[model samples]
Target: MPMEKTEKTLLSKKELLEIFVNHRVDSPFPGDWESVFKGLGYEFWALRELEPTDSFKNIDWKAKARTGKFFVRDFLAESYFNVMILYDVSRSVQFGRKELLQAHIAVSLAYSAIASNDGCGLILFADDIVKYIPPRMGRTHFMEILDAIVHAEPVRCGGTSLGPALTKLLNEVPESLTFILSDFLYPLDFGYTFHHAAQGSTKHEVKALQVLEECEIALPPGTKGILPLYDYESGRTVSLDLTKWQAFNDTMSRQREGTRTLLGRAGIDLLTVSPADDFGRKINSFMRRPPSTY
Candidate 1:
């Protein structure tokens, strides 16, 4: 499929808002959004007279002042879940139209979550965590996330450090339906990190969306001679023999399969998306599918 010309880069706020509106009117997922998060978290239930065993932290100070009685807030386990987007702003993702694709996917999911009254958060990272917005539910919060994504630029020097980013998320954030969006072009081995994060005390539901350009997967047809490729993160260039295009394709294919296998074993679903694909619909389909088990 041909790429949409307008989507070759991140869209403006107006464009993003339009997409959000459309998604609310015509959601692609099948059942109610609440069903997607069954058995996940809790929501506020009610307030009742404070019991002797109730902690002082739960006491409603305002209620005590108003009615001259102690009351404590209560919660119920429910369908609420945090939707966290961990985006890679590393130089590698600066490749042809990858960031644009990331923005589309992130915006769609954030809007969907907020529309369903679920909390949505964002973490932008490269060599480390660049920015983080804790999961929150509101139009203002969604706009903050949208602003961060639209203005996000790739880090100028360092390669991706997904290990630290994942570590931070696992340690700090609550259990969430987390989505990692990146090109997965870094050389780091983060398989163990992913495994630990998925199976940690929090038991986060992790998913990954690998954004890539079509040419990155395979060289153009009828390519010949030496092709010079530049490494964005390293500021280095390497010459490749086009005669070895098939070898390059084989290596890339293996790398992709290896990633899928590793994340699958960690119980994380992996979806590879390209600028030419219908990413919104693809993301909806991916979300509908259950996470893979080891």
Candidate 2:
């Protein structure tokens, strides 16, 4: 069923803190968050036969003495990296309880990254970049991010300018694990832009969280006759025939599948979610699972 429009308001500090606490309790992420996310760092990788070029400093003396063969301990490079969150504040996202859900997801991710001792940054965008915060760590930085999410408002005009935002991220932001949260209702060459972002000198580990309303996916089960559907981004209303709801669902499904395919080809992950989903669990699973598993 189509949900009633929700009131737009700022989330109080108490509410935000409650959400964070709930997420912490529900999340499956371990205390050593870095262990789950493998990357270059001081973390021990493995032991392998030592080669002529291998540094003697890394030699495993015990292993060599036991096996009577030269072996060296391999360590992963520094795994510390920033987590950049690109949030869409376009008008379309304000539909139903989407913005609220988005807030939860964003806040949870920010807190998780910070808890993992990683720097977290944010970029809020509508037709263009509305605000940008460089990645930083510490409790104070987390508060700043929480404050931004709490006060975030959807832009009253213009469509999503995802392309422009990606360009800015590529040009300015350092390589990081980037998550783009949006409804993805706008028409843009997602393949080209995402592929570009996932490759080259500024390559980043990009992922997407597509937040959508149930009604946007399909009309109510008993829907009938013509309905006036409003385009929030454009501030226009168009009549939609309820009889063609099946067709509408098919079209929306195809669009979503197309997006998923495009992003997957670029080695990026995409997770579609609704306002009622368990965001903390979903996020934990998404982070832990491989892209192919999606």
Top-lDDT candidate index: 1
Query: Candidate 2's residue-wise lDDT over 1-294, tens digit each?
Result: 012212333344458766654565444222223322443246788788876545577789999889999987766435577888899898898887777777766776777678777888999988888888889997679778888877888797666778767776777776777888988877654444435544667657788888888777666566779888788888899999988878888899999888787777767678888755555445545654434422
Report lDDT per candidate.
Answer: 0.74, 0.71
Top-TM-score structure, candidate number: 1
Would you give me the overall lDDT of model 1?
A: 0.74
Give the per-residue lDDT digits (tens) of candidate 1, residues 1-294: 122323444565457666654665454222133333432345666788876545677688999999999987765435567889999988888787888778777877787788778889999999988998999998789878988988787888566777777777877776788889998876645654345444656657788899999877887666789878889988999999988788888888999888887778767778898877766556545654534556
TM-scores, all models, native as reference: 0.73, 0.72
TM-score of candidate 1 versus the correct structure, residues matched by position: 0.73
Clashes of 2: 5
